[model samples]
Target: MDDAIRKAEILIEALGYIHAFRHRQVVIKLGGSAMEEPAALRSTLQSILFLAAVGLRPVLVHGGGKPIDRAMTAANLPTKKVLGRRYTDEATLAIVAKVLREDINDSIVRQMRELGGRAVSLHTGSTQALFGERLKLKGPDGELVDLGNVGEVNKIDGDLISSFTDAGLIPVLPCLAYDAHGNWLNVNADTAAAAVAGFLKAAKLILLTDTPGILRDRQDPKTLISSLNEAESRKLIAEGIIDSGMIPKVEACFDCLRSGVEQTHVIDGRLRYSLLLEIFTKSGIGTEIRL
Candidate 1:
């Protein structure tokens, strides 16, 4: 009876958030070690289900980094990573599309269905083409280097996403997009999510990652910063506290905030119910980025 009462109380506590975000759109970027571990993946997906069931329209942008690596290994292709971003060549791009669409995206949709939720995959080709542009990476000398087949979200298909959400369906977006010339391009999932959130003018952009949010010291859990703004984030980057791969993720959140997204959150997806804890409770679990 005590446990039942506690559960009821928790639901009541979540009532306010559920009502506040009702009918609003939220973009979720899900991946990393969170997808690799079965238990973490299940818990996180269930949280997403909960969000949808409660009336907030949720969209998912997912990554397949590990799966792409495995595909590259099978193809006997050399994997080159620069600044936490993959140097995607022609061969590697092919595998990225295959793994992202066929393996990771399809599997996630299947899993979402299994959990009693309706999910749809936004295929990477022209019919969907979540983003329509190519990406330019930085060179060793700080020059803009063009990484072949990599994209950085120039535009998004807002209507397509809205069309699905309007029908009470969750849209599972692939990180890959189309270039100006009608070619497929690989995009980082974080960048993809930020762009989507900005286009949707979403209420929030939630990133489900492996870490315990952003820490003042990467090595120390006790150094976690629960909230941050764009200026503070820039200062951290200038100080090298936020560099390499983390730079892009942080920049993406900042960009989202600047583009009118209300808030962006980076949370530890490994902890069960972390999504609910961050949204429904007074104190969120991760570092929330705002203006």
Candidate 2:
């Protein structure tokens, strides 16, 4: 069939990309609208399997923040978010850690295995006391308060990630971490992914977010800027063009680029094979930020 031939061609192209990037480490932050949509979730799982089958080294760091919020609400716990990071108090942190480490993490491992990919899920505290700083935020009502357990990633162990990757197991890292004194802290998944990418000197940091990429004009889809550097991103932030949920995403991209990650990409994971399109095609589906 002609369709079969077309499919074969596509697969061959994908194989070429894999052969080219073989043994190169790629850290993927799989989250945002992609995780929220049923179709997107299936596509991402399949994409990972395809990448592994083709011999492209892939490491995944996923976000379950939205799921945790739903669980908290279902459990009748008071939930609050500061600067987009969940405020996990002593009580909430227990619930969060349980959901993140036990529920979401296990599900990812199970799904990846079902797809024939060797996936190993892990929590930050499993290896060591990776640290973060608690952030203060203004409440929804504009009240300034310190949100406990909601922190920004300050440190991570690259050795653990490398060991897992070197053994041919894809590391599916959860965003839950522990303080130096053994307190549980919740880190933003984007920041956590970028940290891991930096530590490993990964060749690529691919963020599977909702938006197609960074658009110069938020209202204009065609205004998507293909690439940016640290200084350019900071200037955009200073100009107030970059704010809201984009701040952390931009920060993560900048961090990865500064730390020698070859290229950082923010793509709309809603597409079935956006990762492949970005990797193999000339025109990609999202933004590519570099140093």
Candidate 3:
């Protein structure tokens, strides 16, 4: 009886959030260890399905770095990184496209269906919702460094994505976009998700990563910062607390916030139902960045 009562109380706690977020779009960027672990990925997908079932429009964007690496190895290609970003040559881009579209994207859609949720794949090989130009980086010496097939998201098909969400289907997009010349470009998943959120003017953008939000001490999970504003987030970045891979994620949040997204969250996707806890619970289990 006590266990049942506690479950009912949990539902009551979530009621307000459900009502508030109904029909509001929420963009989720899913990657990191969660994608590699069966249980974590299952739980995260279930949470997303729950959100859709309750009337919140959820769009999923994913990155498959580990699988891509494995595919590259099988094809005897060397994996390269420049400034913590993948340096995609033609060969690498081919492998990336195959792994992300044929393997990861299709698998996610299939899983969602198996789990009794409707999902559709939107990538270069399909609906091609994202479009961008090739990306170039600068070295410390101010020299233009070419990251061959890499690109940044320039535009998203808001109407098409909206159509899917409006019809009670989740659109699963792999972090690959098409250039104006009809070439496929490798885009950072975090940036792609942010662009989608910004274009749709989503209510919130949630990045599901491996870490337990942003921690003051990188080595300690207990030091997580539950909430911070844009200024504070920038300060943390300058202080070196938020460095490397985390910088892009934080910047993605900044982009979404600037585009009028109400809030952005970085949470540990490895935790079961972390998405639900972050969105529905009063004391969220992640770091929320607001303007």
Candidate 4:
């Protein structure tokens, strides 16, 4: 087959997905070591822009935990985490705010704009889209761990986000939220994206992370499970196969699915155009969880 003809074939194959998802919404949670590599990050963002350009509404929610850690290290502040969730005190919240709101959020918007895609920063702390109280986490001994200034999603401004997506603008939402008392709180990006997807009842919640989706065997890449339903996913969690940090991610998928999102996808961000492949092709590269 000629290369040009092969390219056309690819597009023809993608046409089915384009038709199905046209004018629908996909909430993307971008995270992990993928963000540290400039090439991979650029490619992922370009894929998102392509989705937006092709008439799909995309809401981007991101976390800059690595950069926040660097900032803390520079400031001589001790970094800590309980159960893989950051412990954000007042001082740490400031670093989180700066890294998420000022740095990462603006940079994503600028990148999207530079690529000819219009994106608006909708940081919950700034946009008043999310309001929450402090989050109390549990330890192994069943003790409540006080992670000050860290919040779980209590409320989200669905209408406000809708107005932006409805107007054809990509919203770049960060993990920083605000409490009722107007205090800033650091929300986990995975849960944040899940909450946003559930609020909009989005068609798909796509999470781009470091691993090869959900692997049946942690050591083998070939053990990647391409698809799983809600029950199977929950069973993985219950069996401790999806323990640790991955637990939150899979739980977020379950949350979105239960809230009417048709599917949740976990794709490897290291691969170029992975999002496009996962969404458009018949056999996707990652694990897709459906109802």
Instruction: Indicate which candidate wins on TM-score.
Output: 3
Q: Which parts of model 1 are misplaced by more than 4 Å?
A: 124-129, 140-142
lDDT of 4 at 39: 92
Candidate 1, residues 1-291, lDDT tens digits: the string is: 999999999889999999999999999998888888999999988999899999999999999998889889999998987656788888999899999999999999999999999999998554474756666767789998767778788888898899888888999988988777777788999989999999999999999887899888989989999988888988998998877767878989988988999989999999998988999998889999877
Put down candidate 4 lDDT per residue, 1-291, tens digits, no spaces: 699999999999999999999999899999887677889989999999999888899999999988998999999999998777788887998888998888888988998899888889887544668777888987899999888888988888888888888899999888877888888889999999999899888989999988989997888999999988878988988887777878888889888888888889999998999999998999999998776
Candidate 2's C-alpha lDDT? 0.80
Clashing residue pairs in candidate 2 are none
Best by lDDT: 3
Per-residue lDDT value at 22 in model 4: 90
Colliding residue pairs in candidate 1: none
Candidates in order have lDDT scores of 0.88, 0.80, 0.94, 0.88
lDDT of 3 at 183: 95
Clashing pairs in 3: none
Q: Where in model 2 is the C-alpha error above 4 Å?
A: 1-16, 124-145
Candidate 3 weakest ten by summed lDDT: 119-128
Against the hidden true structure, what lDDT does model 4 obtain? 0.88
